[model samples]
Target: MKITISVEQPTGDFQKKLLALLADHADDIEPDATWTKERAERLYLALPTNARRIVKEAADRGGYVSADDLRSGEDSSLRGHSAAIKRAVDRGARDGWWPATLQSPVQAQGPGFGKVVGYLIPEYLVEVFQHAANKPSRDW
Candidate 1:
């Protein structure tokens, strides 16, 4: 069955919050270069509990995080609900909050598992993340 799903993009206010969060962690994200294990770990440790979970789980597996990982809480680090994370990611991608690259229906093997969609955080975003960190927070 072919189906289309629609999600509302984040509002300017929310986007600003996200940007502030990104900027706050710009040093950790190291936006100018690719993410290395060391860099990822630093960011992982630096993130708030919720974001940490998502980033750690994904970074541990080559910078790609699947919906299943988020939903099932496969990694102990994942704190937020899968649906919420999914929504935030969808909006972030659509609104250009960050530059994570997303893909759908990648193959997998396991019970209760099937093709899955995921996101990849690139080095450039890492750089932006760092730059944003230096920016002042705005009230939105």
Candidate 2:
């Protein structure tokens, strides 16, 4: 079944890091040329299932790196990479590989709860949902 996913635009630290990374790749590159939600979704679809799984699991765990983590310099690159993985998963969800209905309940609370429910959907499925949502007749 096709699932439709809606995603908000990337903002704040996520946007800044992405722009910096792209700028480092080449001179004269426009900061605005960085990947958009549509581009991110496509990249997510191209990833192998294993990579997608790693990303999805990480997102499920809410393993976001804080500013302190970056400043510490220990495992900084790893955390950045993980953050990129998270963006991909988020884009995949936006595109529809992961259905909104299956997303872990936002209102849910308690320790270890998100881990148990959030990882239920595989990454590939999230991608599917995202693509489905992008179809012409799909609603937001």
Candidate 3:
């Protein structure tokens, strides 16, 4: 027997908001596509000097990229891309660009041999909460 999976595409306000966010950050680094560090640097440079400074600072502080950097260029890592997308969506939602819905945190069971007694949260939101009591952080 074979099982089929159905995919639900993002639609309505979600689609429109998602598209607008993509458009606003089109120059940013994309995942799985052929984008070089040189291109990312160029895009980063194209932004306002303040934005560039923010990216540099964030990078220096051990952040893969500043929120500004992600906004200005396409990132290759799914985590980076998701974070950037979230930032954009959050911004647009705040600005009334579209009605935003609550996206429950992504979750997963911890690796174990016996009965599942523990859970692991996504890495991103780990810093926010004291424990993994809530839903897992976003994962691609």
Compared with the true structure, model 2 gives a TM-score of: 0.25
Pairs in clash, predicted candidate 1: 23-132, 23-133, 26-129, 26-130, 30-126, 30-127, 31-126, 31-127, 31-128, 32-127
Q: Where does model 2 exceed 4 Å of error?
A: 1-29, 64-140
Using TM-score as the measure, name the better of candidate 1 and candidate 2. 1
lDDT of 2: 0.40
Tell me each candidate's RMSD, in Å, in order: 14.9, 16.7, 18.2
Instruction: Show where candidate 3 strays beyond 4 Å.
Output: 1-31, 64-140
Best of the two (1, 2) by lDDT: 1
Instruction: Please name the candidate that would achieve the greatest TM-score relative to the true structure.
Output: 1
Over 34-74, each residue of candidate 3 has an lDDT whose tens digit, in order, gives 22333233333333444333334333433333333334345
**Across residues 45-127, which tens digit of lDDT does each residue of candidate 1 receive?**
34455554544455455546675556654454323333344555455446544335532111222344443355454433443
Q: Return the top candidate by lDDT.
A: 1
lDDT of 2 by residue, 14-88 (tens): 879875876786564422323334543454454555434333443344532232322333442322333444555
